[model samples]
Target: MATLSASPNPNPNPNPNFRSPTDQTDHDPESLPQMELHPSSDQDPTPNSNRNFHAVLPTPPEATAPAAAAAPSLLHISFNQDHGCFAAGIDHGFRIYNCDPFREIFRRDFDRGGGIGVVEMLFRCNILALVGGGPDPQYPPNKVMIWDDHQSRCIGELSFRSEVRSVRLRRDRIVVVLEQKIFVYNFADLKLLHQIETIANPKGLCAVSQGAGSLVLVCPGLQKGQVRVEHYASKRTKFIMAHDSRIVCFALSQDGQLLATASSKGTLVRIFNTVDGSLLQEVRRGADRAEIYSLAFSSNAQWLAVSSDKGTVHVFSLKINGGSPGIDRSQSASDPVTSPHSSLSFIKGVLPKYFSSEWSVAQFRLVEGSQYIVAFGHQKNTVVILGIDGSFYRCQFDPVNGGEMTQLEYHNFLKPEAAF
Candidate 1:
């Protein structure tokens, strides 16, 4: 079974940190103009092209107390897929934690900087991307400092014209999401590989496929309610007129074979083939409109998870065959579920659209609270939710029945000695 994860929300405008206000009204799905595509020439597949960028490292500032003085506010949190470790960004800096032992690996404090607004780790350890935070930041927000843990110094840096909303690192390339634009750089040399213009993506919504032989980048298209896909290895591109409403969420599978999307309407979620932009399946969140926090796909690409403003998470089943490496022609035939509106009865046809909107197979609900971040563990069939109040919960979902999720662990990282 596959498991997906995403950030959950509380209100119509649930996420105050990243989302720009958008008109959620549904509109006509007129065709969008396609953008020119370019293929990447390097066929090496892996981004381990250059190591010379690490030869000379800039000295780090003199160390003060890297750990928190007492209690530090949690600003942002992210998991390093390269390593099994998850990182919590605090007012002082960032803390790294190992999941297996549930212990703190090390703490990096902002000796001169104000705070760590956002921090992303590359793999297990060492390389990190840090953006300045605080009311009056010590460093320029437009500059991304590349920190090397081994030498405790800056090895390289990438500077942008505007503040970066988010950064995703792969062996071969660095994908940076800006407010309205995206920059793809050759990781080894920071060479400008591609530039993409998008909608007013204040949250910097962008996702990429890893280790999939082909480098694919998915983000908001030039038009609202559209999704743009770039195939780096083959230099091809496909545009999916995904929604008749503004897009609110996006999730890509590990291998870049599938893409999941949600619109501001929040009533339905659709899955598409990354290779050709074919509609694979469409799922529903609810009948009424709500804000969506996150969308994720399992490692195996068989399951999908969605969290929305209703403080509820729904898991949907994808008709993926267990045996075949790719699509199974018989998988859809073996399943009984079909499109929500695929009814034959006469009475059902006269009902409102809400009556035909899809429902989830399994769901987990939390008490109404602040904004929350949600995601599935990279290698485990676990759902991880992080709340604004610093509470963390990890639980497992029963694939057999799509029943109540079993709690595996919980922690409050904000309190002294409360976080593990």
Candidate 2:
């Protein structure tokens, strides 16, 4: 899933501790033609705001109380396209960290105490899409500032009439999502390529394929329970009525060939073939409804992982292939696909749907009610989870056994002292 930003709104008030900020280098005006769409500022405009440009490290446990008084507020968090790295936007600045051997690669603090609400990274490149947020924004909430870390400046920007809900990036394109519209631009020169209209998307729900040579974009459609798939390569648009309720969250495979969606009902997650919009598989998250926070496909698309308010991360095996009729029903004790099913499944049609629904093969439990996003790790059979409560977990699942996953690592990225 892309990084979600708060709805565009004016800053409440300026932080009194902020100090004057140093000016950033101006972009070459002769570089690109001025057009209707413009970007925002990276240089802090508040002359009295404090600026603390430094590499941030975890405060010692003994200093936790004091640090809490001045700790930077987390504004946003997201994984890169490949999930090899992740970024966190804070009120003071943003920090990027490696995923596998988790470590903060670098951090940029605007001592002026400006907040970054959204940070979209293109793989691990220096280029990033940033939007201002929090009580004291670093930039206007209506603009998407393209930041170039190598130069330590904003190289370009995309301005809109309203606040930007989120931004998606690819090697060749930049996608900006508003409440009801989406704009696609050519990355090389920031030329507007296409525009799309969507339903009231306050969460800025959008997903794009990261596979090279293919452009697949998915967003909410005009009607409830609808999803729009844009296949730029084939010049085709496919709309799928994914559910009867409102779409809460969805994810596309790396190749954009498969899509998984959960609705406000949230008990069921359906996977579809992007090419034909055909139902390929359906998995149950629970008998009762729950908010599905995130869904992800393994690099090979053989497994699907889901996280929800239930404080559980469930991994389900994907057995259906594109263009195939349905899931392969042949099963045995030795079968590799180990997703659990109720023993009452024998009378599926006679019993409630819950009795026959397929359940996760493996699960990891956490504190209930906190938001967490999950993604399959680069390491095989591993899943990486990031939580709003500052928890980071990496667990390995036994594909053949199907049960509780083994916790391999844990860290409180937000409160490192807690990890100690």
Best by TM-score: 2
lDDT of 1 by residue, 269-373 (tens): 998887788887878788778888888776666678888878887777777443224544243344324323425334656876555555566677775536666
lDDT of 2 by residue, 1-420 (tens): 122111222223222211111212322233222222222232212222213122222332244344334556788989988888888888867777778988766666764566899999867666678898888888878878776654455546666779999999887788999999998877766667888999999999999988755799999999999999999999999999999999989999888888999999889999999889989889999988899999998887778999999999999988864332232335356545756898999999998889998999999999999999999899878999998766789999988887999999987776533322
Listed in order, each prediction's TM-score against the native is: 0.77, 0.82
> Clashes per prediction?
6, 12
User: Which residue pairs in model 1 clash with each other?
Assistant: 7-374, 39-235, 47-171, 47-172, 82-123, 83-123
Distance from true location, Cα of 244 in model 1, Å: 2.0
In TM-score terms, candidate 1 sits at: 0.77
lDDT of 1 at 134: 59
